[model samples]
Target chain A: MEKTGADGFDGFVTARWSALFHLARLLCGGDRHRAEDLLQEALVKLWFAWPKVADEAPEAYVRKIMGRAAARSARRRWWGERPVDRLPELAQTGDMSAAVAERSRLETALAQLTPRQRAAVVLRYYQDLSEKQVAAVLGVPVGTARSHASRGVARLRQILADVIDPVG
Target chain B: MDHFEQELARMMRDSQEYIPFASEQRERLREGVRARRRLRAATVAGGSVLLVAGLTAGLFLLPKGPAVDRPQGPLTRPGTSSSSSPAPSTSSPAVSPTQSHAPGTPTGTGTTGGSSPPSTFPSGSVDPTTFPPNPPATTATAPATSTVAQGTRTARPPVSSPPAGSHSSG
Candidate 1:
């Protein structure tokens, strides 16, 4: 029974890791390491709750955990800093393509918004969740969730105006 | 949704690059679960210990009924019941002076002075006329009479002594 549960959990995490990581990235406003940390933290909690939520929606559980953690971490900014023996790799401009440039611009714009705004925008637009669903996940009122998404979209539009044509 | 919103959603979807769940991450997750489990166990164990300790301390600190109910000091001892003994004087100040002066003088009212003679009647029967008109103090020294009188006087209230004055006058 234990082995089957473990296998089920592993298989689910392995299958959904990429999608969950992406959501975590967006929720964290494009901080790759922070997104990885957030995803890992949510997954650990999911391991404990797997028995209850496994037959239902484990992905939704993970998404809720990540969203709430991302929102809460805004007050505790120390998680962004870490003692590292080696410096991180900088973005290479040598092999830069339009897609990579666009991705970078998008991430840069996302990073400009607060954690809550970024999470709301990502959940509403990317995950295709309604404002009420976003509010439930973030533990906020629907009006607040809608406000966060609208304000986030407004900010993103201002930042990505030059790249994304307004005519389309 | 507007065109910009559509474009924004498209861009968000396109930005996702697939990342496989690696062994390193799996190991880290297992470690986190184990660490949390150990922390929970320790917290429960420590809390139980503290609760038991608090209850035990409360029990030990409680006052004992038997110890408190037992009378204190030699003054309360039965050996000091003799009329001549000064211990009863210190213990019961009200009865002591009457016992001491009862053998020498006929103190008036006999309320205080007559207290010692009533205990001498072991049969619980005493004729009021047996009390001398002028003095009940003469009978105060008789050991059998004085002991019985003192015992009775200590047990019964002084109001019972008024009958002695009534019969003494008759």
Candidate 2:
């Protein structure tokens, strides 16, 4: 008797699918498969609460879910002794070689930061939440959130120091 | 208002990527919901059957509904009530309310053998558990506003709308 999931919510999902996919893709460092999975998990949770989000801006709710998904993906692992949350091990596959190569470079750099760091950076930068709102989404103190943005940007600057030298 | 805040805002605008896939994903959300509904229906039906069986047995065995329900003169006589109560005493703890209500009884909660007087509770109101879930303590804390949203709960994690058709027996 619980209508937690929306009836015909998938229809709404179909309309927003492209935008949701891209949001996931950006947070995932443009990895298409992981982006699709993250987008699906988030939309599932959203669909479960579809009636509530129906009145609100669906895009913002989806974005919050996407941030949570991206944070979770950044915590996965691989082969033993050395910790490898960042996936340098996987083989690259795609038709566009140049774009794939650049995206790979960005993925590695983004992976170097912890999930929250990357989430803070991605949300504040790509998703464009104010620091206070970012804190609300991440469920951390504003001061702690501000530090994540600062340290995340600082880390990204160091990693991309060679290519985008505006920091130097 | 602040320079660093503005700078951070500017940095965000620099990296915005939008990738779209509209058709493939939404179909999965619908399937997940259908699976959940089937599970809930199975649970409710199973519980209803168990409840009906319990009431039928209670009606057959214990004919006098309660000590209070039927008047006392028939029971107060020597052997009449004692003869009827034998099987219930063997069945469960609550069967011997008559044996425990004897004059000059030392303890009140006859089965539990507690020092607390039976008179501590008014004639019918005995146990806290028998008291409705919201006792005086919670009765005050319960939603008091006349305009309180119907079935809709306040916005918080533990708060949620009462199930669509759920009516409180109270």
Candidate 3:
């Protein structure tokens, strides 16, 4: 039997779901629900464009959509972190707990930066993209992209000072 | 990249949890695609309706051309007086009154002849040569004269000279 468009698309989405979800989570500043929404929206778009982009770079297409949408929504409305006395999730025990705590701290710090800066930083460091690639994804100039990443990293250095100790 | 950058990258990679593509997610994606397709179809249909309606309105709103000025009756022979019939000179007294009242006769000729006093008739009638010369002048001036004279002339009856009235009333 011939492999249909839907089958191909489903397979692609299944294969890349975890990586894309993580990218979305970071893009949305670690809000799981918002990350899911973002990913779902990108997937819907990918389904429509699957015929054209399936053979080429479907993953890149989804990443571009999510990055732009995340930045645009952030600029339109303030999705500020709500301060609470107690933590939402109970602290887990053992080796994984420290990693989870570190991840939480990173997300909290990421949420503090402007949307563009956060997007640039996530694309630069987490995705390991060059400044030009980051610029292409964000639809901005290289200098602008470079500035955003540098400023974002400088801010993160202040926010995560204790978590990431200075090199001896 | 620096030590801090390396650590951040590593932490980002390590923070990702293994998430399977669930049946629930696939269903949701299918539903989302269906909804978007419906919305797009509705938008296209609405735009088409609006475009057709606008074109129809524009077609109706265009200004109409000036009304045609058609001649009211059958084309008359050129150079023949509208008031004068083809009937011979002997039948003049009998035909004159009927021709004057004919619906298609030029209003200017009827009113101009009717407004003249009965005394003016003997000179034109006695010299019969005057009658022949009058046709050309009457035909030329008939159309140029105003029809406003017709309404005023209708109030007073045409004074029929003794000779013509006697011949007709006989």
List where candidate 3 sits over 4 angstroms from the true fold. A1-3, A81-96, B64-170
| Chain A TM-score across all models, in listed order | 0.90, 0.74, 0.88
Q: What is the TM-score of chain B alone in each candidate?
A: 0.41, 0.27, 0.40
- Winner by TM-score: 1
Tens digit of per-residue lDDT, candidate 1, span A1-168: 889999999999999999999888888767888888899889989989999999999999999999999878868957553323332343775788767667777877887777788889999999999999999999999999999999999988887888789973
Off by over 4 Å in 2: A1-12, A72-101, B1-22, B35-170
**RMSD per prediction, one decimal?**
10.3, 28.8, 11.0
Q: Count the backbone clashes (under 3 Å) in each candidate.
A: 5, 4, 0
Predicted candidate 3 versus true structure: per-residue lDDT over B49-77, tens digit per residue? 99999999877765432234544676654
- Expressed as tens digits, the lDDT of each residue in B69-89 for candidate 2 is 865573343212333333222
> Candidates' DockQ values?
0.71, 0.17, 0.72
lDDT of 3 by residue, A1-168 (tens): 125998999899999999999999998878898899999999999988998999899999999999888877655544665434333553463656787888887887777777788889899988889999999999999999999989988988887788899897
DockQ, candidate 3, vs. native dimer:
0.72
Candidate 1's C-alpha runs over 4 A off are A79-94, B61-170
**Candidate 1 TM-score over all chains jointly:** 0.68
What's the DockQ of model 1? 0.71
